[model samples]
Target chain A: MNTHLVEPEIVMAYRDGQLAAGEAAGVRAHLETCAECQEIAASLDDVSAQMRAWTVEEPSPQLAWRVAGRAGKPKGKFWWWHWPTAALVTAVLVVAVLPWKRPPAPTVQTGWLPVGSVRTSESNLPLPPAEPRRHDSVAEIGPQAQARTGQLGGVIGGIVSATPMAAPPTSVQRRTQAQFAMEARRGAAIPVPTAPMIARDATLNLTVKDFASVRDVVERIVRVHRGFAQNLALTYQAGRNNLTATLRIPDPELDRTLADLRYLGKVDQEAQNGEDLQAQHVDLAARIANSRVAEARLKELLANRTGKLSDVVEAENELSRVREDIERMQAQISSMENRVEFATVNLRISDTPPVPAPSSVWRGLSEAGRNGLTILGEGLMGVATWLLEYLPTLIVIVLVFFFPVRWLWRKLQARPAFRLPN
Target chain B: MDLTGSDESLMLEVKQGSEPAFIALFERYARPIHGYFRRRMGDPQRAEDLAQETFLALLKGARRYERRALFRTYLYAIAMNLLSAERRRAAKDRGSTTDEPATSADPDAVLWVRRAVEQLDDQQREVLLLREYEQLSYEEIAGLLNVPVNTVRSRLFRARMAMKELLVTR
Candidate 1:
């Protein structure tokens, strides 16, 4: 082993000047008396000195200027760094930062998770009783609803995660790589039922007058229809509150659940989708069957047939690969069946504060004053926003070109290169 | 920041767009970076281009740099990634090409050293060149390579021994 082929790290550290002063003093003392350590130290020093023979030429002076050009312009073209991108970014900042009191994101890991009911088809259980809604976040929801909602299970990691409204339609059943790896190790092959499978999902967007009651109602409705809130999040904004939840109900109760949830508010939009997974399930089943036969033939070959050591190794490799395929196809089939078993309901509820009536003359005057201050703030914000966005780019540009431009200006004033001898 | 400040502080100035700071850093590492690429490839033009790209990449990513890291290691990390990419491209274009770069008129000594350095294992060679050519400390090499300090020490030791054997045989 090379462990003993050379001196230890102490010798190398001593040669490389990596040791502290006291350690260096000790190594130097040892080096004077020890012959083998002396030889190793001599070898390390000679190799370093000999490597100096391979010298590289100094780079051309043009290299720095080319790098400077590319420092600002990514494409190495000067025109690419013009004012348009900065201007566009400034416009966006003015639009976004002018109204800057953003509702903070939900502080994660503060609250409840689902009970073990998610792992089994307990969809026939009755809805838990309804309770009064708290005018806060999902973190403060009741323990009973907590039992039925909001837990970070493996199923939660693999399912339609809770997301905000106006973002987009949230994707359902997106398994993370970690979850799949865990599933692979667990050897939990989902039993593929010989039945037609139709996976159903829906999105319901509603405008509710009473914002606080909506989460409670949605939870109750999911439970009443034998479904569970796979993931839930409630966001509160000034003069408005948003409740967006991804609910998982049994396929039989999807229509009834959608109906009860709509009664909580005014329906603005509704979308329903049903994807038939029978063809995919059949395809996976056939692939698994074929791989299983191949796996068995290899296993039989390894156990009964005599062959060379290399041939046995090859057969073992092929057998493991075939079993891996069988597991992967079986996992895919299981995932599809799980999707078909529960219908996904994406529920979003929003509220707008009631407009106050002008009961007296002060109301009108107060609103006018507020509006005037808002206009003044926006006007000042436009300039501040532009500076905030473009200041960094401006500094980089000036720094990169400052010396060369200054030299050119000084040269023009002193020599006037283009002028004839006068 | 002045020319005498630590490289990390100079880099902080570079983060604030100080050209003098950038110049100080460039002058400090230009030859080492150029040699880093030049020692590993036969083409001087490609090496020059890659060395320039390292500096440009540094400027492009300067804003995101944290002062906790030594500036030299960060710079070498970029150079290493670029060299890796160049080697991959070269391998696909020309199989089994040697890295015998353009050298001084004294070819026998210089070519012998290059061949000896090249004969070491890839990782061990990296550690040796970083020590001999770039003169990076062991801790810096460990940080740059994302390896343990002990690993860097062992690799550097083995590499130095291997180079000694190869050079003597020649």
Candidate 2:
């Protein structure tokens, strides 16, 4: 009657038939005598009996069709998510291969370079000796340009002006000759300021059929005439398209650049003008000289200062202000000289359909549909390209992993939870 | 088709495309697997679908089925996978939160017992259910839950004592 109470764990184990026979006998003896152990045993059995109350019937047959065909693709609910895997792989292939199959985008050249920057120092170049002499302010630099080409065709600016600029350099070789002649005469006495120091510029408006081809031609002409685009803008719209080019051409090359530009399309309008910047150039030069003299005087004071600290500071500030003025005026003169050196041409080429049929809503909708179809066609092509390029590779990759994965899965599937080393 | 063969042997026959053999295994385990899902899921229709999914998984993976272990284990493994997936989906549908399985609508005593079982700690509750209803041995549960056998034993002990205490109070 004095057996100790059985532990709940042993009681449960005995109930579960897990205890050894000897342990079960001992627990049974304790249960027979001990009211507490007997209750624990009864409770253990009662728990199982209670759990048995929550019974469920067999499921209906509706779920039979879901697995009717090869697992019905699983709705990708499982870990594999087969459909998502396929979609992801397809997307990856599309991203990887489409660019190679798609046609290249249009290439439009842009950016600018310095004007007549061919010479580091123009005065250092060899001159075309005594090239020409003329009276009026004409294309003297232009004649020098044409003389090098040996064409002497006609007056570039106006007849009986300065040197008569002959004709367009017939060939690349002739243009090279002109460049060399300019390189030479640029040697000395190239009074870009007094070479009439005229800032010559032109504006040409043209309508062209092929904007791309004409743009290429315009680029070529600028290269030939030793010019560069200062700024160029293009508006490629559906109903209208235009290219505005602000070019900087050496004054001597202005005529040739204009001639080449003229041939791009039918000229809608053309105008050329020369602003005499001689007065401004002279004024800038005089002011700069005066500022430089003042700067030198201040420099002397700064170098050998014999004054109070505040006076020295004031003088130093004054000298700095004077030097700033000098540099500003010098920059203005340099800019003026450069303007005379490179004339600015504002040219616009447009492909706007002239006075034609008005657009209708129906036409717009038709255009939209056509655009959609075009996009869809390209998308399909991208998909097809991806399939052609990667499907085989993907299949090979899947094949590579399928057997081993299947083996491992079967290994896992077989055990279900029975044999573990630990 | 030997309908009365061992589970593994029947599964082998099922793998070999024996229709009668599959029907045999289905009849044998259908209620158990359905109960497995039914105990954890609130919806009977959902439980049915998961049960169907487990069998379908078996049918689909039959070719890959090997005889390295018992057929019931493999079948239960598939049922466990479907249950886990169903739980995840339910959790997501519930704003990404999860609660214990619901108490059944059985009669008064049965409902009390079910509530006490549901109120058990998750691992202990699961261990008790597996041991009690599914009749999985402690070692089988340890392997299924990927824990040591001692853990399964202690959890079962704690679960039974707690279930007894709960049943007494109610």
Candidate 3:
């Protein structure tokens, strides 16, 4: 027997039959001769025996009854009825969540419609007065006798003419004839203006290094061009100044003025539109002529004192209405002329440059720090808002599902095969 | 009537909703599982609760059962989880307190064994208890503990040596 024996690990492995076959044979051959290693092996076996001696009592019989009672309740079974209910709940959840997910439609601003494009209806025009008729007796009285008698004899003869005067042209028929005559004269006399009556307009989006200086330049340009600036707005912000102004320049000088203004800043965007007002101008002129003729006829009717007193009063009313139409037409013509004379330029100027890269490391670090803090604040606010938005939903979900989930959890923990340790 | 089938077969039947197969499994494992819990916990009632919980888990999880390993290994894994949960619950209850109450039910050989086992570190003690009390093989212990077989062997060897020394000193 060799006094030098194997290590304790090999002895333990040997006793447990965990060693390789060759090693086990070596240890077995060694243990056959070594009492010290045998004693160690005996001691290990003694520990195992000592542990095994701590016998524990079996669980109570009622435990099986309780467990079987739970098992017997048809757990883990797929009830055919659950499918429709689950589908319905899923549908409800999807519908509830959809509105929150859908994005809002953006708003679009449509450009203004060109001037006088919409025609004013003839029905909207003022009524013309009834035309005055020459009395039969006045017709018999020679023009020389009426002139010698003066305006009073003419009026007396007009009233003394007993034969009802031939039916006067209706107000509408008279207006149509007047309009037709005007159109005929327009065709013969003045050739319609061949040059387009354009109302010129432009929009400029400019980025400048100095907004105030640029604005001063704009003002100087307007004055040089004999123009005016209207609807001027200036806004000052943290990083820049914004100026929005509408400038009116003579139509002949608009191109030159726009070219000069472009030198003040970088033009990010520029848009020009020219609306033709030829038809509008022609219509306004015709309407004005017709209204004037109506006014003259009403005045004659009133002076002659034709028909009854009611007729006289009615003629005066028609005169007033015709006067209003004339005034309105005059105003429209004036505005249209002004638009054709001057071009409008809408200028939006900003001095804000794009944020540049940080020049130094410290600047970058400070920027990063500021950005981080901002993000943190925003994130916290976002979280708070999210919690507030969904708090009621969360509460309902917890209230509805908490007990069943807890019960199922407890049941899962009770099952020996499937229960996971906490 | 066919109670003599293998644990896997019985589990398959249980998965198919056979009450008899479930009863057969329950009758076979109830006592061992109870004993497993009773040996580790001081309270018999808690042990019973744990045992019942183990069976309930089995019944509940029957539909998901797959025969990847021995049924006993799976069973003991569940028991281990329950025991771990119980320890965590007890630890939470002892919040901010450093002392732990003695948890042995018996005052004789069981107490001595528990004291000796407690003298080892957590890993060695677990290896020793699973090996000595539950009589799980080294390979089974390795699988259950998620360690390599050699590590299990070394840990069990060290645990035995330490346990032997403690018993001698006591």
Candidate 4:
């Protein structure tokens, strides 16, 4: 036997039967002769013995019966229920949030004229009060003229009374006696030629290849059709040009002029309207004739002087009112005739360079890929910025609530269901 | 009464819907399974519950059983998983560690031994207990714990040495 003792680990390993056959034999030979090694081995065994001495209590008899009863029976299916429950919860959340996600309705404003005010034409009506009208030259006409046009027309031909007749006029009785004397001098005058009036207007939206060429072409078309451009505006911006022009063409040549303009570009939109003003013109002509008759009668009454001073003053006032009415009717009649002769055309022209075709599929795909990567990078950067912006709030929330939540969790854990009964 | 067969054969019989074979396996392993849980847990009732849970797990998994390893290895793996789950539950519920001082029948020698074993680190304690009580070899302990045999040997040796020192000093 060797004189020196083996290491304690070797001794423990030998006792544990962990050593190989030859090493176990060597340890065994040393242990037979060496009391110290034997004692160390005995101590290791003694530790195991002491640990093994702790008694293991038998499980209650009910456990075996319960487990046996469960045998040959299929286990309850738990995972099968989880999927449907998750889907139901998701559906409930979506339903609860749906209404809050909807956008709000826009507000609308409608402007109406005050009652008792009279308007002669549709153009005289005011726009909605919420939005101020844009100052376009074609729409503006003239501010002063527009204001005057909005007022009610004066009484005509005694058909519409300006004011209630208070009493029988002394001027009218004197005018009748004087008119009988004047009738012997001259007969009544006849009216001039009248025609059916129709106002023609059109709106066009055009996309043109060359803006400058289109303007020249439009001017040539108007000249050929014996028309004049009312308002011509050209705006240049960022490689694109926008043209807005209002032109007045001869009514007889309107169709030919519009066709020639359409040939200059692609017409994206067009609208035409013709309004008949024959009844309005006829009414005005009749009113003017009646007013002329009244004026002539009043002038005869003033010239005769068969009445008192009050009658003479009344007659002069009547004559002036009649003259003003006739003048207004005459002006309206002239304007109506001009509108019937000319057709108003509103044109909006946009000139933009055509988009270049893609060079090849590979180049197109590569461009698309580059754009996608740029968008992705921007999105990631936005997310990072948002997180950094809210980081302070997150930290404060964690600091304020972490310890209290942990303490409450601990307190709850200390309660009955968590801890075993003492 | 004729129950002399390998654990795999008995498990195979249980898989085939043989209730008698299942009962035989239960009778054979009930004590060791109960003792395993009893040594690890402080409360006897909880140990009993864990032992029953282990058997229940075995029964549930029997339909899909394959003869890959020894039935004892399969049984211990299930027991280990259940033990981990129970420890987690106890920790979450009680806010204390699972290896509390156990109430033994003999409080003098057994209590001292239990206290000394509990004082060791979790890995060393498990290795030592599996070796001493379960009588598993180093290779078996390595297989059960998913470590090398050398690690199991070293851990067991160190655990024994520490236990001896603790017992002697006290």
Highest DockQ scorer: 3
DockQ agreement of candidate 3 with the native complex: 0.32
- Residue B97's lDDT within candidate 3 is 22
lDDT of 2 by residue, A1-422 (tens): 63556667777787888778999999888777778777777878887887788776556544444443334232223425243355457556655665543323223212211111111111112112222332312243364544533442221111111233344322111223344345433421112234346778899998776565455555544543546778778887667688899988777778756755654556788999988877876777677667667777877987888888898899889988986776565556556766777789999888748554438888878888999999999999989977886788667656665666666554544432111111
- Residues B23-91 of candidate 2 have per-residue lDDT tens digits of 677777777887888777777777777787888889788889899876766788788877878777776
lDDT of each: 0.69, 0.65, 0.67, 0.67
- Residue A96 alpha-carbon offset, candidate 1, angstroms: 15
Model 4 global lDDT (CA atoms, 0 to 1): 0.67
Superposed model 3: Cα runs more than 4 Å off: A1-11, A25-43, A57-92, A95-200, A206-352, A359-422, B1-107, B115-127, B136-170
Candidate 2 regions exceeding 4 Å error are A1-7, A19-36, A63-422, B95-105
lDDT of 1 by residue, B81-154 (tens): 99888877777886635265644564788878877776778899889889888989999999999999999988
lDDT of 1 at A131: 44
- Candidate 4 runs further than 4 Å off: A1-7, A18-23, A72-422, B95-98
Q: Which pairs in model 3 have colliding backbones?
A: A414-B53, A414-B57, A415-B54, A415-B56, A415-B57, A415-B58, A416-B54, A416-B55, A416-B58, A421-B81
Q: Is candidate 1 or candidate 3 better by lDDT?
A: 1
Question: Under CAPRI classification, how is model 3 graded?
Answer: acceptable
DockQ of candidate model 4: 0.25
lDDT tens digits, residues A235-298, model 1? 9777678888998776766775675565455678999999989888778877776776687789
Error of 1 at A349 (Å): 20
